[model samples]
Target chain A: MAILSLAFKSLLNRKLTFFITLFSIAISVTLLLGVQTLKTETKTSFMKSISGTDLIIGSRGASSQLLLSSVFHIGSSTNTIKYETYQDIEKLPAVEWAVPISMGDSHKGYTVIATNLSFFDHFSYANKQNLTVQSGSIDDDMFAVAIGADVAQKLDYHVGDRIIVTHGGGEIEGHDHDNIPFFVSAILSPSFTAIDQTLIISLEAMEAMHTETHDHLGALPGETLLDSDHHEHHDEHDEDHEQHAAHDKHDEHHDEHDEDHEQHTAHDKHDEHHDEHDEDHAQHAAHDKHDEHDEDHEQHAAHDKHDEHHDEHDESHEQHAAHEHEDTQDQRIARLLKLKPENINAIFVGLTSRHAVLGMQSYVNNFQGEPLTAIIPAVALQELWQFFSLAESALNIVTTFVVLVGLLGMLSIILMSLNERRREMAVLRSVGARPSHIFGLIIGEAGFVCLTGILLGVILLYAVLLILQTPLANYYGFYLDINMLTSNDLFILLTIQCSALLIALIPGALIYKYSLSDGMNIKF
Target chain B: MINLTDLSFAWNKQPIIDIKELTIKKGEHLFIEGPSGSGKSTLLSLLAGVITPQSGDISILEQPLNLLTASQKDTFRANHIGFIFQQFNLLPYLNVLDNITLPCSFSGIRKHKALSQSKNLESEAIRLLNALGLDDPELLQRSVNELSVGQQQRVAAARAMLGSPEIIIADEPTSALDSDNRESFIKVLFDECQKADITLIFVSHDTSLKTHFKHSLKLQEINQATIKEAV
Candidate 1:
């Protein structure tokens, strides 16, 4: 207590120089801690942002790009997987749930994702916890859209409001969905990941738009938009009855009517063979018609030589329609998985367990099929570290420089004051005070100055963080609570204090040396 | 009593003070005179044991000052001797009273003796302050810096003369004061030394004050041409 009182009194004597040293130390510590705190929070946030996602499957583009487009709002994918492939992947024995993501569309500058309603049920950020709706619910209807919290707030979107989607993945001009405006059905609470930066729509809606686009573009010369394979096949079966009335376009129409009536008659007999078996019946009918056409061509060729030539020509025409119908049905089912004309670019999988990361990895690595991959949202996002590495290094360099400047400033100030204090020191020595007493006095003064400065700096750090918390959350989805000191913060502050003390010793040592030889009359 | 036998000293290989077989009885008042270059300060330092003689035995009260360790010498000086330097005789940061009490704070023997005579010592300090012709009420409580050089020297004399230490070493105590002040300071100091029956070694260039003291010595008479040459 006596020492403290004396120290306080002595410090009060040199308050200006003492406080200056302290304030500089405090500012440096605050800057260092601030930079470090932001760096750590960003890394933790990035890692936690995608922990719940198991695997991210995208089009057969680069795996890293697919992960980025699907998980992080980093880059875009080159293409998308076929719808059929997505369905087939879902049916695999090891697969639990597969959420398909259709990319390559955008609203304003935000990426527009075409996914099922299950996206809300599955997608997890920060943890494996399910995304909760803060205000509105998930949109289930095909044309309804869901926007993340930031997207909604920034764009002033509300439920029941209609908005048009812009095409080509960004703020591009051409092909706006002006004809069919979408309703804003749901807005997610902020997660601060790619969700906050994207728009969500249904896969059916995406498929419809693609199909409409294809129809808008004129078809090729040899192509036809024929309806059913069964009708086309039957038309091929009756070619011999057709060409006899060579100039009759009405005959072709009449043949179609007869085929329709026959199809209706087949439906009437649907009791004998249920509608579920209709596709099987069609397959059998196609084979039988092909055989009959072959027999007819052979018989005509055998019977009358001129009639055989015309009959053969008619038979060929009937076979062409039957083959066309069969090919059309196959093409439609095959198009579901093929990525060329229309395909799924990404998949958002939500697993039943938090260990869904394993499931995601298993699917990507063990799936026995064409080249494919699964990515857990968290892992994939972490793997996208180009920005994080750059940010960390840049912040580290700046913090280090600030700390050096702070220490140097303190040393310079303390050393300067020591020069003015020589007379006071000599007086103490003359009054029967030992050299050690002078040394202790100087060191104690420095330590007190540093500790005071660090205390002020800590208070300032909390105040600044508290002030910026709201804005940071609103802009970046980061919720930094400044109410209590986190372990990371405590560690940083401790290190700074220790470092300041270490720096303070330099001046103390200088004074100690000065008082040593100069006890005779300490001028230096 | 003080004793010096064959004392020799030097600075950077140049001789300073060389004295052989010098002794002062317990009640002697010895005055040392010297020009600016004469080694009066060096011999005083030697006698105070602030510096070691190259070849000598300086014993105060039968303890050889040079034979004792440096720390022991400090203790001996604190307990048995009082010093008045040419300047800075008192710490400027302390008030006049505190400066007067500082020697007692460091030396236990002095402290015990001064405390035993505490009331008398206070009155004596006041008397000495009065005798020095500094009667202002503000002067006694004021910081050392507020006092004139002569007043501060008087305060230093009172401090050194307090508690009746066996030896009092004054090194040009009046150098900073004017002729009139210096004369008054010497008279009072010489009278106090005689009254206390304390041995006094006063080093100064002012030979005019020699008439007041019982003993007078010149630095050059005892100083060597080699080891005790002038600084």
Candidate 2:
């Protein structure tokens, strides 16, 4: 104990060198623990991003790519699964619930997901925790949109604010769907997942926007207007005018049907046009009014016949024309309900039992309608995490080297001072201090420096985490839990301390030999 | 009492100290005078048991030092002998009181003796410092660096005389002081040794100071190694 106090006093005497060594050690400790904490937390948050889902089904592709694009919003899927296949998968006995997601749209750099209300009911994250609205409940109105917490906070959106979505992902310009703007009806609570950066709407609204963009006639059945450049040809050619007049008459006749039956039949008629539009838009646009009318007649004949009220139909036609320039929320909602999605990018599936997961995966892999891939979310997440292990190991190696540099600096400094302290050792020897006392003094100083440095490093780490927690979570969706030290962390710290003592042994042994020879010599 | 029988020592296989015989009774002040490289420091080292002679026995207080191991020798020195140097006598890191009480920290026998003199080590150190003519209470807490050369020598004297060890070995402790301060320093040192009955081994090449000691000898008179070198 006396020797330890002497060592401490000696260190205090060399204040400048002592503090420099201490600061170096403290900074290195901070880096070491910082890298370790980030590695563990990043991996934990990555795994937490998608949970409670048995499998993710997407068009045949790399399972890792599908996981990245669908759950992490990292990239876009190259292919989409047919809506019919999704329907069949949803009805399987092994599947408890399935949420189909359509992507490839963005609002202000945030991805826009098109899903039904079932997404809120079935999609979960971080230990079966369902997403709850922070402000407003989810609405069933076709044009009503629910935005994630990060989207609402970053874009400063509130319930009832109108937002126009772009046709493609990311921040590409000039593809905004200005004709169909959706309003925010709900804002989801923060979940610290990719869901926090998304804007969600019903699939009907998604189909309606694309359909309106292609047809330019607001998805109305049997009323396909020629491209704007062809409008003058209608006046010049009596044949084209007569075709348009007949099509206008057909539209007026259909307006007399009940609202439900009209929307239902209109959706059936729109499906054929949507498929044709997707197959070849230029060819669909080049078709004359005669071909459009013939196709519409076939779709109507396929449905049940209803009585036509000509006067009421004509009045409704005029109202629809008048409402084209300024469509209200109710008018937009009514139009959207009449449309249906043709395909979706991915589907999240939940199973009734964990044991049934493999059978359902095989079922999705051999899906008869289209080529698809179903992957267990947990397995794919682990595979994705492996890709990051190399970078994690690299960071760990760099920080470990930094700690070694700090310890080496301490060793060099103490070794250099040993020559200057020889007279001090001689004085101690004359005063009856054993050579072993000198050895213990050196080790004790090193131990004290390391212990204090570690303490300061931990404090620095917590301070940095506290300051950056909100920004990191908001900007990067990384949630770091600042809790007490884990046993693993304690073990790492103990290892560092032991290494310091081991390094100190080098100088301690040297000084002991010097003191033995310099005994009572009193050079000065 | 201290006795050396046919002691011989060498450094790097070159003879530095060779004495046929040497003996000093208890409470005696003996001044051994020698020039540089005459093995004045080597003789002190041998007396302190820091090094062993090749062919001889050194017995202090009837205990043979050669039989003890290196560690045992260290403890024996701590319990029996005190040392003061020519300069840099006190550890710069410690204050005057801690410097004086340092040996007591290393040796339990010295600590017991010091405690028997006063209530605790601090009071005992103060008593020794007062006897050495450095009675200023503030000086006890002052850093050793702040002391003048003469005052530092006095503090060194206080530390060596603190535990009432049987032997106090000082090597040219007055060499750094002026003549008047040297005399005053030796006066206080001898007064303390006489009060405690500690045998003083004062080694220096300063012949003028030899008048203070009744038993003084030059290195050539007793050291045959120096005689052989002169021949």
Candidate 3:
């Protein structure tokens, strides 16, 4: 014990060099622990993000792609599944609830996901945690929309705001459903899932937005004639052209572009203004193609054809944009609502019982009618985690090497001091210290150096996390949890300490041999 | 208190010390003189139980040191002998007081004997320091590197005499000091040895210091094997 104190004093006597050694070891420890913590947390977040969901089924394609597109809103589904298939699956005895999502739209750069009220009831993420509407209630309101916390925060939108949906999923530019914008009905709280980054709307609204630009608005059965029919579906409204032109002129906001082509946006705004006052005209105005959220893969008319189609839509924009301004109040209220969804990107299926999942999965995968694929979310996620584990191990190896270098530095530093300390050793020997004391003293110094380095590394790790906590959680949805140390982290620390002790033996043996050789009479 | 008979030693097959017989009575302050490499330190190492004789036997305080194990000899030396080096005696990292108390950590018997005389180790260190004319209480906490050569020698003396060891060995302690300082150092050393009735085996080439001891011997005169090598 006295020799141990002597070792400590010996370290303090060389304080500057001691700290340098401490810092190197601390840096190594921080790197090792940092890599370990990130790997575990990433796996945790990934597993938790897709929990509670049993199966994700999409039209015939890669299972990983299907999982990515359906749950994570990444990539595109291989093929669209028909609405009839959705109905058929709902009728299956093993099916508990089937919520269909139709993608391909964006609102303020946030992906819009179109589904029904069942989504609000069945969809769960992050350990089976249900989505919560922080502000408003869920509904199937055609013109009503619910936005996720991220979408709301980033776009600065709130409930009751009118926001137009974009035609595509990836970017916000190009054609938007400005003609028939939906009112934000609710804002969902953050759930640390893909849903937190999406906007939600009703399936029928998605259908209506797409069907709004079609020429078949007035040609339907018994009376699918839109609200604009009351104003005359014939060419009599040609006189209203000059008025619509004046409205388009008033709608222009950007500094660029020719006034002759209003891009349909200006006209929609002016037309809505006119519709608000001219109650009769509002009843049957044509609203250009309104869009939905599930899959915003709106096949555009190509860049060169965009102007040509723009001119065509400009001609029809008068008929449709004017037509929908009034249709919002009339047709929507007339109970002429059931616009059957033609296709959907993916479907989330829940089973009546856990046992029914395997049977239903096979049944869906082998259905002769249409090629399809089904995947258990957890299984697919496990496969993904396995791939990530390779990188994690590689990262761990690099940090471990750093720790080794640090330990080696400790050994070398002690060795360098050995020459200068020979007389100190001889003096100790003459005072009756045995070889064992000298051996213990050397080993004890090395061990203390290592422990100090480890504790500093851990403290630095926590410091960085605390500083980056809010930004990471907000932008990346990574909630770094601070709790009791994981078994793996403690194991790493133990490994470091044990390895340091082992390394000390090399120098300890050297000190022992040197002491016996020098005896009480140091040559110097 | 020390005996050596037919003791022989060599470094790399070259004979260094070959003594037929040598004996020193208890409480005798023996001054051993020698030139630079006349095997004085080697003989002291043998006497201190640090290096066993190559052949033959050595006995100290009625125990056969050659018969004991290396660790046992180390323990035996720690309990009974105190050593003052020529220079660099005190460990630089420790303050003056800690250097003096270093032996008690290894030899529990010495620590208990020290405690019997004082309240604690620090007080006992101070008491010995006071007796040796290095009574500056402030110097006790200063690093060994900061003290003057004379002050350092006194600290080493205090360390050797702290636990009342049966024998105290000084190896050229005055080699670093001037004439005046060396004389004062030997006087204090002899005074402490006399007070404790300790056998002082002091090695130095300074013949002037020989007058301070009760007996004196030249290392060459006693080491007959070294003379044979020289001839």
Task: Provide DockQ values for all models, in the order shown.
Answer: 0.13, 0.63, 0.75
For A96-187, candidate 3 gives per-residue lDDT tens digits of 89999898887766778888878888899876888999997664446678888888888888777777788876454567865457877789
Off by over 4 Å in 2: A170-172, A212-214, A218-337, B226-231
User: How many clashing residue pairs, candidate 2?
Assistant: 0
**lDDT, candidate 2, A425-507, per-residue tens:** 88888878888888998999999988888888888888888988888987876788887877878888899899999999999
Q: Residue B228 in model 2: shift from native, Å?
A: 12
Q: Which candidate, 1 or 2, would have the higher lDDT against the true structure? A: 2
Instruction: Report how far off residue B203 is in candidate 1 (Å).
Output: 4.6
Candidate 1: tens digits of C-alpha lDDT, residues A1-524 = 32344445557766786777778878887887777777767777667667555677765556568766777655665565666667777776555677787777778878888887677777776767666666666644445688878889889987766677777764556777654456777788777777887888877666555544344222211123322322332344333223222212323323453354344332233223333432333332322232344533442333234223434554454332322222233222212111122467776655556655676566665655545666655555666766578878888888878877876787777678777777666545444444455666666666676778778887888788988899998887786645456687777666766776687678767766665444334242
lDDT of 3: 0.77
Which should have the higher DockQ, number 1 or number 3? 3
In order, the first chain's TM-score in every candidate is: 0.72, 0.80, 0.78
Candidate 3 chain A minimal-lDDT segment of 10 residues: A285-294
lDDT digits (tens) for residues B172-199 of candidate 2:
9999999889999999899989999999
Across all models, the iRMS values in order are 3.9, 1.0, 1.0
**Number of the predicted model whose TM-score against the real structure is largest:** 2
